[model samples]
Target: MRALVFPAILVLVMAVIGHVLTLHLVPSVIMGTAMNRLAAQGAALHSFRLAPRTTPQTQLVVRPSPDLAYSICAYHLRGPQPLRIRAAAYDDYGSISFFDARTNNFATIRIEETAPDSSGPDILLRGPAGGEPDGLFDGHDLKSPTPRGLILIRRLAPTQQAYDRVKAIASADVCALSSSAGTISE
Candidate 1:
């Protein structure tokens, strides 16, 4: 009985250690893999690039969806620069999401949420440490807590025709770093 008790306790300790290690390592591993994939593809910071259509060979991101056209803009806040993303309002459903280096989603906006009369599909992203832009309304901007992150744009494309249309829209999507003169509020 004493021997059995000792072995059981040892097993429990090992399990706990394993669980804690996994908790710490999984997210880092996933984020690192994603960044590596992006680099291999020659993806540049603050530029919108349409992802290749989902295929068996595609492995850049998990769970590639054939029904959705996807684009991504990876950014590094080296200059602590502000980024502006703009897309024309379209009939098809779409969304833009921002993820930090650790894979935390800092912000997301859907097409329906931004009316045609509203900000016109324009969004400003700034570092958390950066001051708010002058004369901009609250909902038009978001702050990223991390220096490095990604902006993902997804559009529903249920058919070949829809795919073509969505692809065009995604291609036209803009992600650019704002000039220093324009980044800060006066």
Candidate 2:
């Protein structure tokens, strides 16, 4: 009985350790691979760029939907600066999602969430440590808990013709660092 008790306790301890390690490792592995792939594609910091078409060859992100056009902007709040994202209002469905380094989504803005009277799409994002923004131009303000993260822009395009149109609209979208001189440009 004594021997069995000791072995059972050891097994339980090992199981707990394994579980904790897995929880910590999985997100790191996934985020690391994504960051590496984005780097290889020449995705600059604080800039938005179109993601490659979902093909059997592309492995940066899993389960890519062929019916959608995806774009990404990688950001690092080194100086705790704000990021400005702008997209003209369109008739089709679209969204912008913010994810942290650990792959946790902190904030998301979608076309449906915008007011019907809203003129256009714009967002002001700051790091968790940054201050609030003022004088936003009908923009939504969001805070990210992490200093480094990704901004993903997804637009629906069910058919080739729709895809072309959405692609053109997405091409005009901009993500860039806000200037410190009280001016914003994309």
Candidate 3:
């Protein structure tokens, strides 16, 4: 009985170790691979690119809905300047979500939550190392836990016409660095 107990304990310890390593390492590996793929597809760091409408043949993400338009940005926030993100509010449904290096969603802004009279919401993204931004800015201030991450913007567009319209609006979306003068500049 004593011998059996020791072996069971050993196996349990090994299982626990494996579980911990998988939990810590898998997310980083997956996220890194995704970032690399996006970079290869001409996704510039700190700049927004309107993704082509999701088709089964070109779908990089899992189970992307055909009824939505997507714009993606792979952001690196290690610089001294903080990133500024702005998206045109859709009439119906739209949202921007920020994900950290580990694929953890740190923030999301939905168009429905914007003020009725506002055109859209302005977001300021800063890394953990970045201090409070200089000057007064009317926007949502978001702090990223990591210096590297991705931003995804989705808008509902059921038809080709709607997709084109969403694309036009998304083209005006800003994912750039904030200048010392407190203005966003690509």
Candidate 4:
């Protein structure tokens, strides 16, 4: 019974450690897998007319337009590696997100905002492998406890026709919303 108890305790301790380690590592594992996927995607995206540049090993900064201030700087979210995407915009609340040229997908995070760190102007677009963008938006253009704005992303529509295609998609979504609202009113 004593020997059994010792082994059981040892097993329990190992299990606890394993769970703790997994919890800490899950985000990394997920990000890595995503990066691998993105790397394959980026290879295809190079054809798009985006000036994809690798996230430089050194940090880069984008100064605000004088005192106008921005909720987010679209450039910082660019990359630690070469990232290819159609067009990117600073959404309503100002989160810099973008569309992937390869997969025409979108992604975002707290890419930047109020009182951000001066350390990194990281990359957001991942390679076929995952990329981590600078998670800071250093400057407050809004009130207290800032909002995490949506970083609207779209595949780079370099031409009029490509733009039209994206525009149509947007119009469709907007139309759907408006139609739903109208029906709800009735």
Candidate 5:
């Protein structure tokens, strides 16, 4: 039994090292692959791409909800301007989520939380190096840990008719530079 002690310790050390490496590196690897795939699929930087209804053959995400429509944007915050994201408000359930390079979801907004009288939830996203814009802007502000990331918007639409309606409503969703972007040069 004593002769097996060294082998056992070696195996345990290797397993622990592998676990630590996977935990630290896997998220970024997955996120990077996703970003590249989205870019290759015509998802331009700073623009919204409305994904088609989820079918087994058309699913891009890990496990997309069959009852929701999706819109995506692969954002690159390297420029001086802050990005503006606006999701059109709807009576049905909807949400917008922001993910950084490490696949960390840093922010999310629900449709019900938006102002009913306005177009929808408008948001300004800045990089870690960016500062708050001057004057007043009519939206929430967020600071991202990384300059490169993704934005995903999901709207509940279980059937064909519901999907069509959700798509139509989501057409108004905007992912672009803020109108006041010039003011925030950093």
Candidate 6:
């Protein structure tokens, strides 16, 4: 009986220490991996520009999902929102990673409506990061300045309120993004 108790106590003590260490250690290990990748990709690349196409701006413009990161070759706004892309992209930012938005290991873009009586993130963009962007524009290979980190036009998604409020800067133009295939020039 004494021998049994000693083994049991040792097991219990070991379990407690393991559990406590894992609580913080496991998370740091997992989160650290992702952070390392983002860093390896390099802090938001800051050397690209969008060239306006002569098209009449009749296409529905969309930005790519940040998780589906890729080289943003070009992005344009024909509507009145004064659309601007605050982004940091890599040289190979044109890679795409589209997956199921509901249940997938990868990131996704979800939609939600804001309440009239409250201020909050109305439309939810369910990625590794969550956001309530008013509008969201997405395309695999878009032409833009910053070519990475889920380039958001800060609420470019289509909805009743967004359509009405930001229609001026809104356009049906679908912006395209992709890798340049050579050394990026300044």
Best by lDDT: 3
lDDT comparison, 3 vs 4, better candidate: 3
Pick by lDDT: 1 or 3, better one: 3
Model 1's C-alpha root-mean-square deviation from the true structure amounts to 3.9
Using TM-score, give the best candidate's number.
3
- Model 3's number of clashes is 0
Stretches > 4 Å off in candidate 3: 1-12, 115-119
TM-score for candidate 1, please give it. 0.79
lDDT of 1: 0.76
Model 2 over residues 43-145: C-alpha lDDT tens digits?
Answer: 8877877765555686467788887777888888776678887654557788888999899988878854665665456788888777767654447788888
Score each candidate by Cα lDDT.
0.76, 0.76, 0.86, 0.31, 0.84, 0.29
Q: In model 6, state the lDDT of residue 19.
A: 94
TM-score, candidate number 2: 0.82
Relative to the unseen true structure, what is the C-alpha lDDT of residue 36 in candidate 1, on a scale of 0 to 100? 70
Candidate 2 residue 89 C-alpha distance from true site, Å: 2.5
User: Between candidates 4 and 6, which one is better according to lDDT?
Assistant: 4
TM-score of each: 0.79, 0.82, 0.87, 0.33, 0.85, 0.28
Clashes of each: 0, 0, 0, 27, 0, 41
Cα lDDT over the full model 5: 0.84
Quick one: ranking by TM-score, best first? Answer: 3, 5, 2, 1, 4, 6
lDDT of 1 by residue, 1-186 (tens): 887998999999999999999998898688877977897898877887887776678657777788887788888776556787776455778888899877898788886677766533777788766666767444467888887888888888867788778776665677888764244221
Q: Which 10 consecutive residues of model 1 have the lowest summed lDDT? A: 177-186
